[model samples]
Target: MRDYDEITAFLGEWGPYQKSVFFFLSLSVFPNGFCGLSIVFVGDIPEHRCFIPGNLNLSEAWMNRTIPLEQDKDKLQYSKCRRYRLDVIKNLSEIFPDPDSVNISEVGQEPCLDGWVYSKEQYISTIVSEWDLVCNNEWKGPFAMSIFFIGVLTGSFISGQLSDRFGRKLILYGTMGVQSVFSVLQIFSPNWELFCLLNFFVGLGQISNYVAAFVLGSELLGKSTRAIFGILGVCISFAIGYMTLPFVAYFIRNWRILLFTLSLSGLIYIPMWWFVPESPRWLLVKGKAKEAEAIFRHIAKKNGVTPPEVFFTDLELEDLKAKSKQSSTIIDLFKSPNIRAITIVNFLLWMIITSIYNGLSLNTSNLHGDDYLNCFFAGAIEVPAYIASWIFIQRFPRRLSLTGILFLGGVVFFFIQLIPSNLSIIATVLVMIGKFAVSCALAMVYVYTVELYPTIVRNMGIGTSTMASRLGSIISPYIFYLGIYYEFLPFILIGCVLILAASLVLLLPETINIPLPEMIDQMQKFKFISRRDHMNLDPLYTHAATEEDNTVTQKTEEI
Candidate 1:
């Protein structure tokens, strides 16, 4: 029985067919990048103060007195949510020779009954300004972001099943349309409730489209190119989209216009339906041998190669059919002791990585700099991180690299707290460095987790782990809320969680250059040394009896 890789060998790896598929599939990831994080700009809270009614009737001194003064850090500013009683202030101004002589501190204050006056220096309009999502209603901002992640969680859980039942291409295009339409609808939302409701569906479609395209690209591309496209291509595309976001947000400024622009960008992908092909592997698994053969022939012709009349034999088809029938469930992930340990560790690592990644991203406004520059810096940092990840995954042990980067990120976060409040620039730089480390770990874990699970349950394992990550994202927005109690509490919590996750990573086996397992029994028998022990071993005996025994056992189980 021949494998798909053997068949793909004849079609060529870096030819026009593979390149086109790679380009289109990766293009889909761009819009997902910004749409997911657009809330950072759309919900931004600008400098504001209470609007004093009938202020024109008063003199300059009395007008200033209408709003009480408060100390923020070293600077004094007008109170944001409250103003003194206008009638009392007017009466005092008339009775007293000088308005400044009256003690403003003794005056009573009330909530801004006439609405708030927002600063237009940065944003012309935002959801925060549009709906007055400030002061007592500040919690709504993070809650809207949380609602979107809840949709992402829903989408991640359902996308795989839908792709399996339907096809990758169908689900990919369908979800893309769903994401696009609902995102546009967000601009028309009259209230915050409706906006959040639309955002929920947008999240559902966003992640579904992303995962479908990712899986489709992996299946369609040749083995030699698969790892590159899977690991680096999609990620770099996402970074480009993310970097583009700040520039767009900076220029547009209005929340509705920004969303409309981002949502409309999805239309560019509509033409992809004509260009992108369904996964040939999925077709073959579903017994559509002729369809799969047609796609292979199309790929060959595009690459200027000719295929024999009998490209695939009946015996090979039967073998593939039998292989596809051997399915696994979520329960299989924890049915065995070794596999269970791997599952639990990967789940927790994903949670921590996701929390730190998003927690730092959503908290960009907290940094002392332009929100656009900070966000751009955050996205730009990931580009090099992805490149570094590609090199590290090939050279270093996956387990140690994952643990080391995560630990480094945590240590950076710990030091961020020690920076003086006045040195916000230094703090911002430290946060970006920490973001870089976390980004590297995030890229490594995706490839590492796939390599860790057996082929039988690879999709299930990744799906389950992705769900865990979404759960972490849901909590991420709330993590910043901790600042209400203690200014540095969010960083301290993330740092502690990341460090604890890094320690757990040490328990998992490394997968660098190791043959991927095909079954539970194979995974159970696999053995690995700690990176320190492996480094100490003699190169001549690196593949000695103990290692050979495990390799032989894996092969025997496959047979």
Candidate 2:
């Protein structure tokens, strides 16, 4: 029986048909980039102070003096949550006949009873300013972001199963609609509670849409183009979308308007439904050989080639169906000692990479620099990181590259606290450097995990790793919250975790220029074979192992 790769080879690699699918599918990933990180601007906390009631008859000096002064490190600023007793100040001014003579420091203070006044210089409005989510309510800002990630966590688990049961195209369009609709509704949210509830559903659709596009592109594109399009193409598109957020937010300062604009961007993808097609490989596995053959002919016509009279024979279709019918459970992942160890290590590495990557992205606001520029730099840095990751994977050992990047990121985080407060620019640069390293590590671990797992349980392994990554994302926002108690606590914790994760990576075997394992038993026997030895292996023996492995790997890619 002929394989799908052979069929794709006949269709043509990187031809007009494949290029069109790759372009449109990459476009679908744009919205996810902004939607995931919109909270950095929407939940921003601007400079603010307690509002002084206008009814009190007082000079400008007394009015300004009503709010007590406090020291944030070396800089002195007005207290955000507290103010001096206005009535006591009024009486004291009358008795002393001078405002300056009465020491404001000795007077008692109280929380803002008349509400707070937010600064409009940086942001005209934000979720924090509009809802007074500062002071005791500050935790809610990160909580909302965490809620969004919780939805992503839930979506990651079920999207694969749904796409398998239905079809990739249907799920892609359906989830895109769901995500776009819920994101628009977020603008009309009456309160934070309602906004979080809607945000959860939006999260569910967000990752689901991304996964569908990713899998569909993998199945439709040719092998020569699949690695580039699946790994770098979608990521570069996402980075472009992410880089647009700071510029968009800079012009549209109002949080509601910014969200409305970001959410409306999803509408641009609505036209893609007509241009994209379902995976022909999936159709053949579902026993619809006729439908698969029709797509093949359409692709051949688009590529200006003629299709064979009998493209997919009945026996080949039956074999594809039989392979698809084979079932594997989660328990299978833990049945073997070597596979189990690899699974545990990969999960930990994913969790660490995700936590640091997202934690740095979300914490861009805390860095000592312009928030918009910091955010833009954060997004912009990843473009090169992705490119560098592609190069590193091609030229270096997977384990060494992964470990080196993680260690580099961890060291930067550890020393970030040592920078002098007066040199804020130096500190910001360090944070950006750390962002760059973690971004590369993030990209590397994804491909590395796929190479490590056997084809039989590849999808299961990646799915479980993604779930752990989402769990890390859920904890990331809260990591920034730790800064409130201790200025350097978050950095210290992230640094320690990353370094430990890097050390654990040394335990996994290298998989550079090696034939991917087809079974858990093969994976157990896998070792660090050099390129010279790998080349000397018998051609027939290597071909037999690789043939089955490639088929299973291709199917795994579609998930």
* Residues 404-457, model 1: lDDT tens digits: 998998898889889987899999998999999999999999999888887778
lDDT of candidate 2 over 1-559, digit per residue (tens): 8768887677778789888899999999988887768899999999999998887777787887898888887788999999998889888867775678877789999899889999999999898998999998888999898899899999999998999889999999999988989988999988999989999989999999998998899899987777787568888888888888898989999988998899887887778887788988788778888888888989989999888898767777668888888767777667655676788888898888998888899988888878989999999999999999999988998888988888888899889899888887987898888888998888889888888887878888888899989999998898978986788888899889988988988878777766677566545222333222322132211334467665654443332
- Model 1 local distance difference test score: 0.85
lDDT of 2: 0.84
Measured with C-alpha atoms, the lDDT of residue 189 in candidate 2 is 88
Kindly provide the TM-score of model 1 when superposed on the true structure, using C-alpha atoms.
0.92
Q: Model 1 Cα displacement at 113 (Å)?
A: 3.0
User: How many Å off is the CA of 1 in candidate 2?
Assistant: 2.6
